[model samples]
Target: MNKKTSSFLWNLRQLNLNICPFGSSSIRRMMKGDHLELQKPKITYQNSILKNLLLLQSLQKPLLSVRFFCQGVLVFQLEGSEIQKRRLNTLTSASVGKLLYPRQLSSDSQCFFMSDTTPHLAVDGPKKMMVPLEHDLSQKEKQLDFVKHRHLIKHCNSMSDVLDIFSKFPRFSSCNYFISMWKIAKNMSEDQKRFERQLLYEHPAFNQLCDQVMKEAKTVKLQQVIFTLYALIKIGIPQNTYLVQVLLRVVQERINECDETCLSVLSRTLEAMGKSKNVDALRAGLRLLVDKQIWTLEHILTLQTMMKCIGKDAPYPLKKKIEIKALKELDKFSPVNSQHMFGALAALNHRSVILLNECSKMVAADIHGCPFWMLMSILQSCRDLQYQNLDLFTAIADYVTTTFDMWKMKQVLALLLVFESLRFRHIGLMNLFLKRVVDISQSLNQKEILCILHIYSSLNHICDSENQQFLEAITSALNTYLPKMSSFSLLKAVYCFCVLNHFPQEPFNQLFQENIINELLTSGTESERTEYMLHQVNACLELEGTSVLKSTAITLRECSSAPFRSHVDIEEMLLNLLENKRLFLKNVQLPHNYFVDFELRMDSKRSKVFPVSEADAFIAEPDIIRVALLCVSRSAFCFGTTHPRGGLGIKMRHLKALGFHVILVNTWEIKKLDMSLAVTFLKNKIFSQEAFPTAPGFAA
Candidate 1:
């Protein structure tokens, strides 16, 4: 065979060995025998033959002979006749034979063949054809001989051959050979390039190639250095290795000499290698380029790389210069560069409404092609900058809704989190997202489950249909994934349920068990632990109609002395007293539009004692007391100005007008009251004559 045919056959052999499901042993056995064999030429084997026939046809070679055996009995053969030759030609031309006679070949039958001769057949029919033994052996021999004489370099043409040669003869290989082979490979098809990359690390000379590149580090051309570094990274070399460090030093030394394109390549190479300490050297190089006025869109991309590598540690001046230059070129920014620019700005926490508007316009124009990650980056930047552009968010939501099914779990969670952070919710988008979560619910991790639940609960409105299905799916997933959840995640989950006023029986029981609750409470900061414990207690109270553990209630009451009780903690304490019947009242009103907190009735005797005339309807009924628990900051009331309608003053007026003996208890004051003290305060308000002391002049 000519060199081209030989190379084709060699590649075919390699592909067959790598991809064939039956393994190389089958191919090896076929090559060793004078005739090929298929023990039970099933449809699958027939399909394999038909697929290989395409490769064989490219060789323009003719089949010589064919044989079929059934249980060692020669059931059919085609040979030594023009009619048989015509049959062979016809069979080769007819690609649909396997489909036509898929199961016609007996399970006991075996097909075999020999090349370079005419077919001899006892019967005339099409069947699965095996590879010719001679051709297979000849190809095998050529491969062996090629390996044996690979050091001579004459047998090497493709990148694979070069790799094989280098693998066997690295000590004798020249740097020129390595460079030339990579250059040749660079021009090959993507598949060939991918195959070569896979072979690169397995090649015996991989380490030697790295060593040679390092040894000639200073002498290699800039392109050679770039190509070498690119290849090393593609081959999975460690970025922090001494070899990479030496290579980086070489690149840095020659960086000033590089043109814009070369500098771009160098920057990307450093990025691909994840080198951050080289930021100073790279920044210096970029400054040289900048001074030379060699900047371009590529430089902007490289700037993003630098930002990612250096993070906030990048000097303010360098970042500002890059930002100014990048913004000036905003109109010229592609979708990809725009993404990087936004990401860089977010990394530095830089904010510019003008730049944001420019980015917004660009993103709006190219939102169709914007990838999931790019959308995430834009949203993240919006959040970091606290820039709320509804138009931009709407466009992203539109894209995500259309492509919701294509998203992975992480992407879905990230998109949901960004939406939640921005407080941007779209019903269609949320429904699609929830459906995806349901489909992949079994695969979701604890963190992802918590994030989804958080997003749902955080939204101001979630349609009941989606909410029910979503909660059900999460409840099912919690059964399987709860044990794997971290204590922090579990706590968040409880809080999420409490926020939504949802607590599935099984998950809540598992979640609020004594040990799990105790573990959760002990692991977080004092505030976080207290908040989580309160959520658990509230969820249990809402879903199970009882206190959590007595210990949990006591712990919450003790921790409630933090001098800043949260709204939930305050509610939990009040509910605990009510559930225990420590502070009894015949009539109680839950929170409503007029009453800010709980309303309770005092004893009848106390009511008669504090009675007022019916003309002054503003006076609260002697039997009634309305409680308002205010968690406002001390500053809120300091200036005698409260927030408009939701403020304490407005609430106090509304409650007093509704005939309530309004008692305002600040959270700071309530936090100082234990269970006994809190009950005492309530009882004192109820029965004490001074508690309802006739408003300003009424008799007691």
Candidate 2:
């Protein structure tokens, strides 16, 4: 018996067969027969598996039946996008694969849902994606012919078989033959891929079939055209060919007929040819298709395609639709796909906590097999969304630690950027990264070294005896590239050095020269950001870099724009409560051009709030405590965690540096409490004896 037949029998033996149609040779014949089949082979186990119900509904074929077991159901469809889903719970080795006959998905297909645990189709053909049964007899006869051809196509397992199938039905089965060939090629080992590439690269018949596929692009189904295009690119077919040009014109004419999957295919096809303008056009075309096709993401491939189409700049409403649709199919998402979805959404600067947290669960569970790039993307997303799941980070760190030898410096730098931006620290990962980076310090580029210095400057970058070696290695690398950098970048690098208290001797002369100082103050690129960096650099020098730049006085002008007002519920309520007491000052400008959420001057003895900026000279008294309420939103903290992000840390540090007592007001928490209780919470937090120490300009 074949493995499918054997597994089917073992599954029958594990469950009661009285109610199952498989008591006969039905499932067995379905496994090995020529008729269309969707088989999910079940495993045999020691414990007895339960089967309280086994329902089998026969369709046209004697052996063909839609089967479901109490303990077994389909977790995913095996055939077309229209097939229904059934659950096979606790089935460890579950994969849905099918030998589909040539025919459109019939009206019998259903969208599976459940009232309780047992998976079932509540309704059939809800979206009408299936073919109608009202076609004439000749059409059905044509379908029968297609099915026979598809059966022959299924037996194809090698590149030679692909050639035979293409020659037999070059018009009808060309798409399937291309897909089959790619499947065979992808599963091959390195030697196999090399041999196959040699076997097919210059074959005379391959060129004829390539011309056939390009000709078929005009009248064939748009779906087949796209599939053949993508598959041809994946195979050894030269990308810069007339075939791609012909298909490109055809696709442009039929752009509206393209679905989400086709859009993604066009994206990949154009990407392969380096036809970026066409890819951008396809991205622009998405705005029209999104509304109608957004809800049709039923398969993993479809979802991934939709994700690529959505990309970073899709509108928020469209992104929200993708998020909701993704959430429904979340259980079916593979680990890499899940992280890819997260990365796509996060890149748009849109975040869904439910989605982020769910994907994190999947990533943490599948740590060992997850790719380092996917892990880095998740970290970047988490950092973008201000979500820090330590469990996920720890799992990724362990995974990277195991696979450290395979990582490139660019990927390691990306990890450090995420860690630095998120204000996260991993002692072990850091050590591994430091050692690797130090060993390759000679090969480091200007951008890479600046990234390292910035990370160290934001993190625990105290230059102690133990840290001396790492700091020196980074500084040594920076010294080589500093002279080549622009004035703006050089200024930022020195600011980071001053923050770390690691003054390299080479760049100081170039950084403080009159010409460089003028360029730093007046450079047009990133002017506002450059001004802010200069302001901080001036402060860093006043506190730390005093020995140098004594003769050169850097101008400190406030480029601080008016911060957008937050209308969040907690902040509004807090502002109202304090406004009635005449003590809440909105948008109070602090000493170093830092704008606060609200400033409250209160009596230390009586805990009474008062306004000191007014004519009241009571502000001069030492009994008053100046409190700056930093109303932080939910996004300000790490996603799903309570830790504040790196940006918030900087704001708090700057507030404290200006001698204003900083209080981080978590709006998400206080927004839940009643007004009376919230007042009590605020009072206790503001007046309690506990005090957070004044942090350094760049706290390690």
Candidate 3:
């Protein structure tokens, strides 16, 4: 027999079918012919037992001997002579109850007896009975019990049952069935309410529920309306949707009826939406709440929202009241609340030692638990306030090292900026961050990629191998993104590369080509174009040690009437001097103040007259010729202009008094003077004669 048939017979024997009214002769008839064939294999144990009992009741043949016991299968022997005994001996070993019968049964009288729990049955054969072991049975039984428990949770009768089951197995709380049931639950405990909030925010079904609630927005209760809107905002729903408008109208209609909590919620919702038709009502509601001394964490949040929404439009008195109240209740603020409070204070440019210290303590206590964006905001607030706390920076660096993978792209960039702003350095952390940036560089836009490069270049330290690797990755990807870069980003990229002294030639040429510089100069505002041109000239000189693009020079010269006229003049003159062989020197300092346009030193030496210790004896000392180019402004040389002496007279007198030759070139005069005339002017000042003749009274 197969294992299935053996299991069935084993179960039947355990059921003690002999206790029934059926005799051994009936049992023999039941086992005869096709009755066993009528029973299909692999039937369940219960069905097998019932079918066997029914067959026994229908038995027609009688038996000579019949024996029944409580624990084993039934056995019968026929009343006939040797024919019956020989027939029984001819029975196959494949019979269902062959294992249950003992071989010692009397054979001469053609009789046998079957009894339950026969000890001699074991000696017949050990492998014939395929009973399962205790361990396997217990394992299967436990699996069956767990399946039943899951079924109960899935088709729970009520919300109370779901809550009970969830309490027992908190893991099941993530189930969709539980989430749906919890949404419609009428009553819940504090813990249940907190769980519901978490589910409503995280569950995928939340938006569908939001759509439903918003569709029936007019009928939703005030409390439900507030919570539904709050949840939607938390989930980042756009505030300008039609549903948002409906919700806003609902809140506006019920504004007067709302208590402090409801008012705070409405204010925050409106603030998040960044719009409100009834500012007066919101301001008044807040004022009344404050007058009633109903300060809470919600009040602080509402105040923050108001500051953000109204900005400078917020009334002075209302702002003052909110600030005072928030300060008074600073002790009760949580980390999240403190973040908002600090953000609001920073926005208004308000600073307080107590508030800042408290915020620092909260953040230091649980830096890892803080949200990435919140941490960024706190860092930003500190930056804006120029507040520095060593403990806070240490905590932030620790958290970033442990949980950087949890940060988003923008957060990572912002954190880097904070580090740069504070001049904080953690070489290992920065190196790891740069590697991550390079890994994700392909996915970043031109602006984002440039930002990373900019941060790296802006650091005050020297470039290491990791920094060089980051640069290589950026330049390799530069061609793909360079075409889409804005002019500002393009300029910044070039500037960064030049700052690092790691210029990539192809991108540099592409970015600073003649057409691009012309477009920038012609299209940008005077200040912007001037700045770009200046940076282009500086970058080219630093990287290539050559003049700027010809088109850039022409643009600068043609835009003479531009706002940065003097600055443009200075740059052109400096570039020209840099390129000229006669004027080029071992050292040159660019103009930094109103007095000097450019300071140049040549290899020529000269002698200067000096007095020895007031003895009135003259002596000559050798000195290098220091020539200062004073680019005279048009206003300074105008006919009506006044000077202590004459026009350009007092400045020349000062230069002569300082024992140095000064060259005064009129702005108009320099515009007319080309490279040779400029070179001639410089040679005269340095070798032949002073460009400015001394006044009669001045000693020289």
Assess each prediction's global lDDT (C-alpha) against the native. Answer: 0.55, 0.61, 0.52
RMSD of 2: 18.9
lDDT: the better of candidates 1 and 3: 1
What does candidate 1's lDDT look like per residue over 1-700, in tens digits? 5854765566445434334447757756654562212122222444343344334433443323121111122222323221122123233213223322334322211232223222244112122344353354354344434433333346566655676566654533234445456555656787877776677667676677666566555544677676667656654556777766676777776776676566556655655655357645765565556535524445567556555544455557666666677777776677777766777777666776777788787787788867776788788888888877767888788887777767776876788778777767677887777777777788887667777877776663355667777778887887787777765666667666655556566565666678876775665466555563464445245333334332233234333322332365555655553443333222243323222344343333444222222313533445444333434453333122222211344345445545555555455556678877765564454444644443222232
Better of 1 and 2 by lDDT: 2
Off by over 4 Å in 3: 1-257, 291-312, 346-353, 383-391, 402-411, 418-428, 435-445, 465-467, 483-488, 525-530, 533-536, 539-555, 558-700
lDDT score, residue 340, model 3?
Answer: 74
lDDT (Cα, tens digit) per residue for candidate 2, span 1-700: 2654555555454443433325546756655662212232332221111111111211111222223332243332324423345665432211111111111222111222121232244124221212232232234444334434345456766676667655655544355667667767767787876777676655556776766565456556798888877777777566556666566656766778986667677656654554355555655665557656767746766555556555666777877777788888887888777667666666556778888888888888987877667777788778777777778888887777778888777877788688777666666677778887768888888888888878766664443444777778877888887657889779878767765656666776778778887876766788877777677666655544557554444666666675756746655566545555355766777655668877777666434566555515766778777788887787666444555554455566656666678887777788889887886666566655442222112111
Task: Tell me model 3's lDDT, rounded to 2 decimals.
Answer: 0.52
lDDT of 2 at 645: 50
lDDT of 3 by residue, 1-700 (tens): 3654555454445433433236556655654543212221211323222243323322312222223212244434333222122222222223424222321221111233232332353433322322332243344344333324345545564444544444444322122333335343435566665665565456555454444444434433575576666645543445666555656666656655666566666666555655445444554554555445435445556556554544445556656766677778776677777767667767656565667777788788877788777887888888787777767877887888778777776876778778767655555567778788678767777777777766666553334767777788878777687777776567667666655556576666776677776666666466655564444444344334334333332324322322323446545555453443333222232321114555554323321211123212222423444565666664453122222112244335434444446666566655777766765554444444432332112122
Q: What is the lDDT of residue 247 in candidate 1?
A: 66
Candidate 3 has its poorest 10 consecutive residues by lDDT at: 101-110
Q: How far off is residue 564 in model 1, in Å?
A: 6.8
